[model samples]
Target: MAQLSDDCFAFGGPMMSVDDAVGLIAARVSAVQERESISLHEADGRILANDIAAPLPLPPFTNSAVDGYAVRGSDLPLQAEAVFPVTGRVQAGGSAQAPLQAGHAMRIFTGAPMPVGADTVFMQEDVRLDGNGRVVVPAGLRPGANVRPAGEDVAAGHPALKAGQRLRPQDVALLAAFGLPHVDVRRRIRVAVFSTGNELVSPGDRRGDAQLFDSNRFMLGALLARLGCEVSDLGIIGDDRAALAGSLEQVGRSHDLILTSGGVSTGEEDHVKAAVERAGTLVLWRMAIKPGRPVAMGIIGGTPLVGLPGNPVASFVTFVHVVRPTVLALSGAAQEPLLPMPLRAAFTYKKKIARREYVRVNLRQAPDGVLEATKFPREGAGLLSSLVDTDGLVELGEEVTRVELGQTVGFLSYASLM
Candidate 1:
């Protein structure tokens, strides 16, 4: 395992920017521990070990792109009719080992190898065959028509995939094209997840006075599982400090990363921050962003720890913004995909002038072919329904004083990870 410095948790803050917080969390961190290889079928979300290059050309031979007949470029006369004998047949997977000879045409099917010396292919619909086995081609037909040359799809010795890439299903197909049944991949990162709150209950349990079911665990586990983490659910801990500390210590022992919700703020029951600090150190306290201001980071033993807000929406946003990247770093995956494209604002909304805001909005395509975004009705950080109903987020710039109805603004998709 790559060892990280114990000094990473020295920095504490009032409210830090997202980038600064990430840098602080990863300051002493190194790459995840490497693992042995497994079969491709079992390596769905694992990271790649090395760059893969093509051993040979994808097709490895010149073949017909369509169901057509092969012919020489100069075989047919422009004005006069020219007829040539069909010497051999070439269907899909047929042999054309010898070079094609002049004055002879070959019958070629789709995906069939091009005959030696044959440079053109005339479609069956364009030609008519007489009583004798011969083909008559029309004028204006070019050489190498409807033919796929060798190495056109993928050249031999070309780089197929780079290192640190997370393999998708399409990537599996790409590897399959190279005839590799098993590809080298990194092992899954172990993660332990839990929640802490006296007012929280399990889904099936009966609700007491003002108690809410624990959604943070489900959300965190789902997100971690999607990233291919080996998640260990530690269940829920109440307001007791000792219980929370015990659970954190037990989970931190065998996991690379530990994450929990609640008890990270200044409340009487807030123990996540103190426990993590006692276990190792607390790196950051909060961020300048709206809707999720109570985000925190620390280390437990040698594993990374993150304490999220008690509000369900805040917890989810913090997990997506903070914990997701940490898991990505540990998994050795490539940089994430592109962020949401910008869209013009279609409505007006009120906000404080200083803090950054991400408003949930629904998108619509106007008649002018422009995609305009409109804000949702409710915009509370505690309302999970607001996050559910809206299609994506409309990011208001910190420098902008106010937004006009028709002015353009940056839009962020709810699905964006980068």
Candidate 2:
């Protein structure tokens, strides 16, 4: 593991905007230097550590794009249908016996390498076969039609994949096409996640009258897993400053990031603020965002720590805005911003100005065939059903204060949150 500076994230400000908070994380954090080579089967979702250049052109040679009749461009009929003897045949994984003779055609299948002298092809459906084993050629067939040229997809020595790229399934297929069996990727980020509150207990534990089961820890674990992090579940901790401080210091030694939900607010029982201060440094960020206002960021023993709100909905929202970017930075992955889809609103809503808000909503196509968003009936941050029942969230900007029915709004789907 690579160590970060103790005061790397030491900055303070009053009520930061969502964009400002994310920008600060991107600017300050650095990626871990350790990298390892893994097989292509295990490369998906991993960050590429080095650039990969194409060793040879895709397809490797000029081939037929369709199962058709291959012929030289010069032999194409000028104004009337002509006939040519089918003297040769070629199928995928096979080659023509010799270069195509003038005024003759070769029966070729898709993916079959074209004969040296042939530069055009006529689809088998378009051309008919005569009674005497000759193919009827059509007039006005353009040169180089229905034939794929070498290097058409990717040229040799060109970049096939760049460093810091998060490899998707398609990206893996591309690497396989280039005959690469293994790839160098950055190691998964190690993250320590836990929940803090005296009134909380693990799901399997017997619950007391005043205690509830911990859900934030499980939710955060799933979110971190989606980001390809090696999660260390620290379970729930009681509201004691000494115990919290000791836990933070111990986890900070091995983990890249320490994350907790609850006990971050300025309430009487909120011990996270003081506990983090004792371990290292703490910067309480009053984010200008609804339902997720109090977010704590600190550095403990050269590792970063983030404390989020207690509400399940708030934890989910802030994770997308704050923790996602931090994980990407630590992995040296390219930052891909989430672009919201535009849709019409089916309900009226209002929010305070200067604070960004996300409203849970279900999307449906209106009678007229346009997609519209309907806000969830309940607005409580503690309701987990709001996230599960809705399709996604309707993001209201910091400047917009009111939304009218049928107005244009930005919709972000739950699938894209990661």
Candidate 3:
């Protein structure tokens, strides 16, 4: 569990920008200290707990890079092709056995160790065998052209993988190359997810006349799972403030975070704000952003809680900006900000100044081979299909009031968001 102080996220100011909110979280939130050792196969997506230093140089020794002949740099031809007698032969997994005699070339295959006196290599394709069985070499070939020196890739005792890195497949490969069968990684964060409001019902449950099946809980669970979280589905709580507060307090004891959607706004029916205030500290922030404006952040029983909007699209967008970073910070993972891809705007749009907006867009290649972004036709934060049909979001900065056609805009692909 995260041992956070009650006033960890205390901000009493007016509406803040998206960058300000994220910066606050990065500055305040602390990572969980619990860690465990796991096999290399289970290390992907887990946060590394320690830096791994290379025990030996990569490649470990000087060796041939191709099926070629190894010779002394002094023996290399000065201007014309030179012929030298083949002194010895070496293949991959074979030793040099003896040094190459001066003016002689050694027939060495790829990965074969270089002989004591050899400092240059000539690819077999670049050289031919003379009628007298000597190896023919071309002129102007640079010395050390095909030679890979020791510690060329990574030196011994240098940092290969740093602490706080979220291990990917390639990172796992590096661990294997270092002959490590297991690694130490931070434990997966435990999140308790639930939705508020009486109008929501669990999917597959008998629905009431005015109730709709809950979708945000499942979506949040899936997003948390992608971040390697252990999610606990707490089901939907009703509009009653007492019951909601009780549940939040109880669940906060065991989980690292409590995430809920709906009831975050200031409506009379909205109870999450009051419930969290009753349970612990609550900082209701009015983020200066579209789709997700009313974001409730609080701490309960030493655990952090984030109350997102009821609308699916708003919840999704805020999750990307809010919960995602909080999770990364808690797991002690490195801060990897998502960079937007630039594309030409194929449609015109307008927005208010000083508020960042993410417009759903479909991307396609124009006849000229440049990527163009077309906005989704519908306009509503409640439209789930708008998120489904679009490829990604076109981010409009706080200062830009309008976007003209053919203008270049930054695009955030859905595939890269997680």
Candidate 4:
């Protein structure tokens, strides 16, 4: 396996700035080129690796938007109670009858192809049926009503989806509308997860020797899986240099990405960062963002590696803000916008201009359809309950030193949490 220069990770007054770290990572990274084709039913949550165009128009025909009577718009007499014979019938997915001659109407249903020469539809509710099976039309009916023209929903050969687009349920439905049974998507990366600390014990195991439960492993693992990565849970690695290096070597060989928690901080027992530097580059990134100030990024062998803080909340925040973008980039996704919907603040807060801050907050709709924000009671980096209690994050920019009451701020949707 490949490794970095022995002294590449040597200390130099903290590693890289947040902006600089992201730049370095992005500079060294590119999406994998491999593609995986799957059926539409299985493509949800997958990222498109190639451009997808409509094989055909969504409707594929001029159809009715409602169940009504189809007729020649001018045939309906301009006067009250104009009547016409029901020439034929059209149902959804059914062929049209013989073209309507002038002064004739046809019974139609929603999604049915509009018969030729039928320029308009008078809704059943708008017309009264006469004893002769003909229908009376209201005055002032327009030329075309309730007609869904062919290619109206989706144009033939239009770009139905773009490469790097993440497929959602609606996207799958769009594919089905094009008669596509399969989709082409980027191959999901296999990420191997592990943690290193003799002081850590797995869940269900009794703790001893200044030990704590290994929560970050499971948390990060689940997050990676939800992002559509195939994850290999390597559990925990004890703090022996050989064992740590061995585990890293194994993961680097088998996985496209290797993620580890803890051991990046400087302490006698914290050798994760040292081992990474010995085996590969482990650049520490002291971000401008708070509660997740300590972030590490570098390449391990041919695989990318991220080292997050041991604090659960710090790990989560760092993963979302810093690591999530990198993962999405490597997975060939169109980058998501960072700006959230601007919201009015319900509380006041202050911060240093040099450092960015992410405040966990809950949102409630006000009487006038505006969103009000409330901060969590506690704001510690290790308090997992803060994440559980809050709806989403309020990002305070690096320049703004203080925010006053009721000032408008950007609020990210909690619906974004996954």
Candidate 5:
């Protein structure tokens, strides 16, 4: 993690906008330069450390695209039906015995290298075999039909995949095609996740009447795992400032980042803010956004720390919008855009204050085959069921005062983020 300036959290003022906060984090955070070599089987979702260029053309040679007969285009008869001698046969992985002569066709299978002097191919279905062992050709066939030219898909020395690319299945297949067994990728980010609250208890444990199960740690751990980070669950820490500060200091030495839910807000029990400030520095606090507003970003003992809201919905939303990008930046991966799709609003909304809002909405197709976003009846940051019942969030800008029915709104899908 890079050492952010002590005044980075000053932010010129307080209550930064969502865009400004994201931009500031992206601009200041630097990628961890450490890299390692891993096999293709273990490279999925890993970021590339360097660009990979094609060692040779994709096909490596001109070949037939279909099971057809290879022949010189000029040798085709102008009339409807004409007989041509079958001089030879070629299959994939086999070399051409001789150059194709005029008025002669050679049997060729799909993916077979084109025979010497052959400029065109006619599918077998279009040509018939005569009783005299000759192929009957049809007219109007164009040159170079059904033939895959050399380097058609990719040229030699061209970049196949660039650095910072997150490898997917198709990307792995491309590397395999070039016979590359291992790839150079950045090391997975090391993260420590814990929740702060005396009233919090882990799942599967008997909870007291005043205690609630700790859900944020599990959710944050899963989200971090999805982003290809190595997560260590530190469980729940009480509101004791000394214990919290000690935990932060201990984890900072081993992990690249520390994530905590709760304890950042200005509440009596919120010790995270004070503990982090005592241990290190608080860079930013309280973003101007709904569902997730009291977000704390800073560094502790040289490790980056992000404190999220205690509410499950707020925690999930803040992790997606802020922590996801920060994790990617720390891992040396290219930042992915979170652009939302346009959808018609099915309900009306009014907001008197100027703040970015993300409303949970369920999408349904209208009778006219258009997608409409319907707002959930309940609107509370603690209601986790709302997220389960909705497909995604409908983003309302800061200046927008009201949303009328049937108005176009931007929607961010849960699938895109998760």
Candidate 6:
């Protein structure tokens, strides 16, 4: 495990903006240098450690793009369709029997290598075979028609996938096409997640009158898993400082990062910040973002820690905005920019504060073919149903005070984050 510098989060300021917080994190944190070579079967969702270059051109040979007749373009009659004797036949995975002679045609199947001296292909549908083993080719057929040139898909020695790319199904198929059995990828990140509150209980546990089910840990665990991390659930911890400190110290030495929900805000019951300070160091305390503001970032026993708010929506948003990027950075993946699509606002919005805000919105395509975003009926951070009912979020900048109806707003889909 690598420890960030002491001043990594020592920004002397009040609540930090989302951009500044993300920039600071990206600058201070370094990728884990460890890498491993794994089989392509297990490479999906793994980040590439190095660029993968094409060993050979994708096709490696000129072939027919469809079932057609290979012939010399200049040999075709200028007036109308002319009959030419079928000289040879070629099928996929087999070479041409011989060079195509002038005024002759060769029957070729899709993916079959083009015969020597043949520069054009006519689809079988465009030609007819006579009873005497002769094929008629249309005069209007263009040169190189239905022919797949060599290296059409990918050129030799070109990069097929770059470093820090997370392999998807198509990427694996590409590697398989190149006959690469294994790939070098970054090792999975280890993360420990826990929730801090005396009133919280696990789903399977019997609950008291005042106890609520601990939902943040499960949600965080699933989110981390989706990010391709190995998650260790530390379960729910009470507000006892000694127990919290002990758990933090124990997991800090084992995991690459620590993530906890609750006990981060300035309240009497909040003890996570104090326990983390006692165990190691608290780097960042707060962020100037709505739905989630009291996010605490620190280091414990050299392991990075992120403390999210207790509200379900706030925790989800904060994890997507703050923790997700940090996890990717630490795992050696490239920082992916969040590009939101512009959509028309269906309702008015007003926020007097100068803080960045993310509103849950459901998108609908209006009858005029324009997409519009409508805010959810409720706006409480504790309302988990808002996230379930909405398509994504509408991001408002820090200076924006009001949003007029029909105004274009930035819309980020939840699919993008996933």
Compute the lDDT of residue 229 as modeled in candidate 5: 95
Clashing pairs in 6: none
- Candidate achieving the largest lDDT: 2
Q: Which residue pairs show collisions in model 4?
A: none
Off by over 4 Å in 5: none
Q: Once superposed on the true structure, which residue ranges of model 2 sit more than 4 Å away at CA?
A: none
Give the Å shift of residue 25 in candidate 3: 1.0
Tens-digit per-residue lDDT, 1-418, candidate 2: 5466766766666899999888889888889889999999999999999999999998799999999999999999889998999989999999999999999999999999999799999999999998899999889999999999999999999898999999999999999999999999999999999999989999989999999999999999999998889999999999999999999999999999999999999899999999999998888988999879999998988889999999999999999999999999999998879899999999999999999999999999999999999999999899999999999999999999999998999999999997
Q: Per-model C-alpha lDDT, please? A: 0.77, 0.93, 0.92, 0.80, 0.89, 0.90
- Compared with the true structure, model 3 gives a TM-score of 0.94
Q: Write the per-residue lDDT of candidate 1 for residues 1-418, one digit (tens) a residue.
A: 3345566656755777666656654555555757667776886667887899998898888888888778887785577567878888878967875666898888889889888788789888988887699887778776678888999989999998988888888888878888888888877888888888888898999889899998889888988888888898888888876777677767777888888888877876687777776667676567766778887677666677888887777777677667877887777766463365778888887677656667778999978999999888776778888777888777765565678898887887777742
**lDDT, candidate 6, 44-89, per-residue tens:** 9899999989999988899999998999978866778889999899
Q: Output the TM-score of candidate 4.
A: 0.93
C-alpha root-mean-square deviation, each candidate: 2.3, 1.3, 2.0, 2.5, 1.6, 1.2
Residue pair clashes in candidate 2: none
lDDT tens per residue, model 3, 7-125: 87887787889898888888888899999999999999999999999988877889898889999998889889999999889988988778899999999988888889998999999
Q: How many backbone clashes does candidate 2 have?
A: 0
Residues 1-418, candidate 4: write the lDDT tens digits. Answer: 2233434434456534455555544555577778988998789889998898888886898888888899987776676778888879989879675899888889999988888888789888888888898888888777787888888888989988999998999999988887789888989978888888888999999889688999999999989878888889898898887788767766887777788888877778888877877777676667767877776665677677788888888888788777777778778887675667788888889898767688888998888888888888777888988888888888887788887878998887656756
Sequence-dependent TM-score of model 2 = 0.97
lDDT of 3: 0.92
Tens-place lDDT digits, model 5, residues 241-311: 99999999889888888999998788887899889888888865678889899998878866789999999
Worst ten in a row by lDDT for model 1:
1-10
Cα TM-score per model = 0.92, 0.97, 0.94, 0.93, 0.96, 0.98
